[model samples]
Target: MTTSRSTYHHGELRQAVLAAALDVIAADGPGALSLRDLARRAGVSHAAPAHHFKDRTGLLTAIAAQGYDLLAAGLAGAPGLRERGVRYVRFAVEHPAHFQVMFQPDLLRADDPDLLAAKERASAELRTGVAGLTDVPDARTAGIAAWSLAHGFATLLLTRNVGGAIGDDDPEEYFRSLTGLLFSPQLDPHGGE
Candidate 1:
């Protein structure tokens, strides 16, 4: 069994401890997480993290919240929906620890205020962009299509389904190029569906 190294007090200990939890999840599976492990990572005593997280579930919840916040931030200031899609995948790739927690609903409170707010912000941006770019008229439908495209690609990358790293001017470039034709703003140039 792992042990703790530090004992952070109240105050910012919650966020700091949560950050440490993410590092653990990133390194190992969620089962590897424990208050003592987080404490050790944070250089605190065994029980230090528990005061802040109460339990492993609490810690995971906080990590998911942070993940959503990071996701929302990445989506913002994007040059366009294309850039945002790339950024979203990049965020998941770069923060696999956070991404893992964010998607595992059984482990965290994805419905928390912070999580909900961040989710809404990300979804709203995607919806708005798709609405402006698609003839689908219905914002939800267009948004779903746009999200499904990039999200499927990202999921593939996450699961290592693509195999091997994407090269310079690689296949991903081919897909990015397709966004123009596949997700065009023009209203059914090929004729209505």
Candidate 2:
């Protein structure tokens, strides 16, 4: 059941609107998001969203920042680069709306302090994951390669580009296997040359 507008306390309205925005983005993409539509979905007045987000960019910026913080947390708990890559894919799959907004610089406030800090935290986590691999000749290049592979796979999965090929297999498990192929010997810290 949906909460009525009258029932939302001061701060709850902001969360409610954000949740509603996520639903809209998940269902219809970020291009379909509108402050007025979010207000309607949240059962609030048209001006309600403006009170919190100020504008559409402001709302998307909030989502992007939240996404980065979530990504950082997910990566932090994983043991190694492979697991971190899997966690990154898992995050993108689970939070498609946030994932969509987080990478679209045109949809966000590039200079927003919160967004910048959150992005850096997530990047640091990725770098730390790559740094764990002692065999890598260049940590920076390795990190980029890992991120590209993971992000590309996640994007393909999200877009259903590989659905027919993946069939009923769990994407995460499939991803884990694929990573194994790439990381088996050369990238594995414990493996012999």
Candidate 3:
């Protein structure tokens, strides 16, 4: 896969390595990730990715950090809670590799400062969206429920588990309808059903 003899000599080696790693994860899942394979895919020596990431967990941490940053951006300025949830699902669908790595804390260096910061940023964005529910006494619970709904739906869609159940309906459209149900007073835990 060597396109140029001096490929790694360029300053973009880290980006190339990250891109290659994403391709590998998309093709074979994160468990198959290896710095050696990434280096090969990036047309560089085996040590190239290692120099950049140090180890597999380190690389996964970087990917997770990037995912959270993207998620925060996607959730930013959403008009309401439902829109923010939709954005979360859209982000997951559009960036499966990053999404996969981001949630599985066990697969990443959870102690990494950059990863922690990114995670906090994403969490704050979600909290902001949930805070829009003025009637909800506990914003934390609402935030978790919102996150669960979006994350579960995104996982189902990505795995094709929804199949033809949604027919020709856009996933986002279906999610919007579902959000109405979720926020309805009848389903409220403290509303006595």
Candidate 4:
């Protein structure tokens, strides 16, 4: 009497495997993922994923790549760099598994070409988004500043630092307002003093 909960057909096992890996990572973080656990989640045999992923690192690399694609898309749709920062936080919250694996490079196959490509794509999009809103002359400085501000804001929001500053008055809105100061056009030469 096997009561199967999954309806995934055989042909879609690869995607099913990835969805299961993300499920595992979201629940337990990247370090806690195992092929056995992923298989269970995917409703496949324990050894099934080896044919697709080779190892746990391979699976994690795929998850991180997916994360980068998602992050690139999220930032691209933002109204401005400030809102892009907010969207960054939103993406992390919505894709906790991808965020966890992408940030913890040591946990995944950082050397994988696919993962590297995705990382570059996401990084470039983030930098391009910042450039679109700022007149920062040097590419490196703009990159550093944009990354630090967005990453720092995302880290703070993800860790619940918002409640301490805003006293629980809809923390997300408060966070958006604070980071808006970071990207204000008033910092420009003619926009403000």
Question: What Cα-based lDDT does every candidate model obtain?
Answer: 0.68, 0.87, 0.82, 0.71
Worst 10 residues of 4 by lDDT: 184-193
Model 3 per-residue lDDT at 50: 79
Residue clash pairs of candidate 4 = none
Order the candidate numbers by lDDT, best to worst. Answer: 2, 3, 4, 1
Q: Give the per-residue lDDT of model 3 (tens digit) for 144-180.
A: 8888999999999888899589988988878877877
lDDT of 2 by residue, 1-193 (tens): 3568788888999889889889999999999999988887778889989999999999999999999999999988576777787889999999999999998999999999999999999999998878777766788888888899899999999999999988999887888778777765445453211
Backbone clash pairs for candidate 2 read none
lDDT of 4 by residue, 125-168 (tens): 77655566545566577667766776776677666675577675
Question: CA shift at 152, candidate 1, in angstroms?
Answer: 2.2
As for TM-score, the candidate ahead, 2 or 4, is 2
TM-score of 1: 0.77
lDDT of 4: 0.71
Give the top-scoring candidate (lDDT): 2
Q: Which one wins by TM-score: 2 or 3?
A: 2
